[model samples]
Target: MDIRPTDRPDRRTFAIISHPDAGKTTLTEKLLLFGGAIRAAGEVKARGAARRARSDWMKIEQQRGISVTSSVMTFERDGLTFNLLDTPGHEDFSEDTYRTLTAVDSAVMVIDAARGIEAQTRKLFEVCRMRSVPIITFVNKVDREGREPFALLDEIADQLALDVSPMNWPIGMGGQFEGLYDLEHDRLMRPAADNARGFEGDVEQLGGMDDAKLATLISSQGLALLREEAELAQAGYAPFDDTAYRHGDLTPVYFGSALKDFGVAELIDALARFAPSPRPQPADPAPISPDDANVTGFIFKVQANMNPMHRDRVAFMRLCSGKFRRGMKLNQMGTGKAIAVHSPILFFAREREVADEAFPGDIIGIPNHGTLRVGDTLTDGPPVTITGLPNFAPEILRRVALKDPTKTKQLRKALDDLAEEGIIQVFYPSIGGQWIVGVVGQLQLEVLISRLEVEYKVDAVLEPSPWDTARWISAATPEELKAFTDLHRGALAEDRDGAPVFMARDTWELGYVSDRNRAIRFSATKERN
Candidate 1:
């Protein structure tokens, strides 16, 4: 509860991750609404979809109705500062989501009650599990017809391999829907009017589930079924374990319909109570603790043009140590230059306001021209590079063909900016004037084209590249690398950072080439050295 530079604050920095069409956007809207960051749900700039998540700010995301960019939002409730990171739900953006997960303390996994533990959900869960990031499951769409609560919980336990504990149980699901029984608080929450999407409007105070007044609201059959299921869920699943949950061994599940806003309030409270403050971050030489008496933060993401009017670039820095005051020059470890951040920002209603000061577990955007980069660490004390941030190998590769020759400079500028955002990779061939572009997924290409048309006013088409995939080439000595590059000059290219890369037609060819050159290493991932 202390607000000093050395004292730790009540911070809950977490992300919401789910598969596509799992009511992820709706849940985000309600969380912001309950946190009082937004005045109304309708306050989000609505386009054709009408209810897209405000975090889906990019034009391509709105058009495709799938979140591809990670959006960071900061808010507070009950004197606890909450940094809610909305990660990309689509599988194409899994790489971005993976990096975003590194910045959070925990994650809320949203599952469709009717369709439990989806493919994308499972993948994201594994990433969380790998880092020991705690998870809280929300079974969404309970108001609609869906699977039984017990079956859903079992599926999660089996698929995720984590102990399942029910924080709240649904009375009846789908058409038979009644409401949720607060297992922890021992109360009843009935459904609201048809127009309202949540259950906060009508709640009944009760001593416990066995209170005599329960018979007034429920039919005998429904009551019996509710009691039977609730009892089994409690007895069968693992009991709530904060220590296990934080260590990623157990998950506390809650049932609700984000569309109906059923259990969002409880979810927020769970985060405030159970979710952790800033934890020690992995770094070279040593790990950085939250209580360290130094300003330390890493740039996990960079946005090229968040505002169309200003056409500015903002580096999203997760405050990992010390309290940050505006105008303080922190050393950018990437270039050994001091960056005096004048306007650090927080997100709300799609607007930016200068952050005068920020503490650990807070995400503030530092606006800069181009001095900062993704994976760069800034600190006021001894410099240490943050670890685990890396660029992935692109699955889809192509050559850019400018539709108008006069716009060559514009296309180059556009590619550079988008590349810095980490959505795409630019490769300059050693022997040709044509530039190659690569991305982890196809949607990233669409986003690049859309941003170019809207933001940079350039037109281009993607043509098939000679290579199917590429790898970063490294050798024990410069002579070995040069000999390989000189022999395969036609297949050699340079990445955005000017790292040598060997382009291959396919995985089979890549293997053949690597086998032939025993001294060269073709790596799929390019990590910071």
Candidate 2:
């Protein structure tokens, strides 16, 4: 065995998060364009790209024009490697987004310059705060009509309770829009009137905010506004404190239009320069560091049938420490089975190539079948489990109403496969003949239907189930759990893991059952060990 040192190349493993229609996917593609990962920006559909080259590859995603599943892409800039995990911005796929957050060391929170902060953005932000994930804020669509930059910064500071440092200030907004005055770098970018490609612009060097060239770029009225705004922003907000930002206390904000490609380059530069590299990942026994000499990683997501031709399942693993070489057998902690990984995948959204070796902070996909699952830890050295990902209780529960009853086998396989992918949760009642599907949000129901029709070719309809919510029930002892299960056998069910689940019509019924069965634990969330 060859000894390897703990020091490795600097890498940034981060996820992009925002509310739906906030140009998250667009920003993702634009970042890819800047990274030299893709050639063109693709067609605009709603706020995202609709071309086959776009990141939203799922058929339903293309049809709905929303990113329903998280996409991982690896790109390099300068000498640093960046693992970009573009997460679903919709609130329905919050579970998948939350799970994806577990794998990223940092996050880029996108806010529509017009809408500012939104509900889903807040939800994802809270999750990041809970995990202490450092965030870089990108105020998108600055070229369009939007709110006042100062007001947006105030809202972010007041609502998110984080110190926000504006790295750049918009010269003017809407019709009078000029360009962005890069406060940090002392540069100015203006929309090129002639000889320009898609979202390309011209840049001018400056001598800080007081540069005389500011007058040439902006009109008299806009120039006054820019000076005032830039002065107030610098004096009012704390400067980009590297320590505070890395500690998840301060966020450096950049103004850019992802569509117009205004501040996208600067945003990428900010990530490479400021975003923390792979940090200590929270685990069960201990947090894992990037400098650990052992190869350690955990499967944060499992996607089935990414390529229709192969019908292969890809388990997305965030390498926490050490270098991972091809054809290395790592011990699967969940099953205690040593599995050999042959074709390790490096993703460019939908386009992928086999990775020969990967380092810490890189996301690699392991092609497998019914072997790896989300939350399962794998290591080449000692036994340790990476924690922090847990399944949320579903708000909506439905029973599979198969149109073709003869395709029962196909329906079973489809549901099982999707469940393994963390797309939906499948619960089987102990006494009922129907299989119940549980999802965190309503859009997931639509996603479930579309995936079944397109991916699995299983024609099925999801009808409202009798139960409104479910709770995974457990007891101190097996005998006690069995007794509780026997008493409520009609209301009891089992998840895909065969863990007992208690179903109820409403919150009142759940409370009633919980009040009676004091000895039994009705858990709203389940953590996979």
Mind giving the per-residue lDDT tens digits that candidate 1 earns over 15-75? 9999999999889988988887666774543233334238788788778888888998777
Worst 10 residues of 1 by lDDT: 44-53
For residues 1-529, write the lDDT of model 2, one tens digit per residue: 4434654547888999999999998899888888776667753222244434577999998898999999998878899898999999989899999999999989999999999999999999999999999999999988889999999999999999999999999878876688888898788888767543224557889886677887887688878988898998889999999999988999999998888898899988889889887888888789898889899999999999999997889999999988899999999997899999999999877777889998888899999997999999999988999988898889999999889999899999888889888999999999979999999889999999888898888889878789999999988889988888888889988899988899999999999989998889999999976
Winning model by lDDT: 2
Please report, in order, the local distance difference test score of every candidate based on alpha carbons.
0.87, 0.88
List where candidate 1 sits over 4 angstroms from the true fold: 1-4, 44-53, 193-200
Off by over 4 Å in 2: 1-4, 43-52, 194-199
| Model 1, C-alpha of 518: deviation from truth (Å) | 2.0
The TM-score of candidate 2 is: 0.96
RMSD of each: 2.8, 3.4
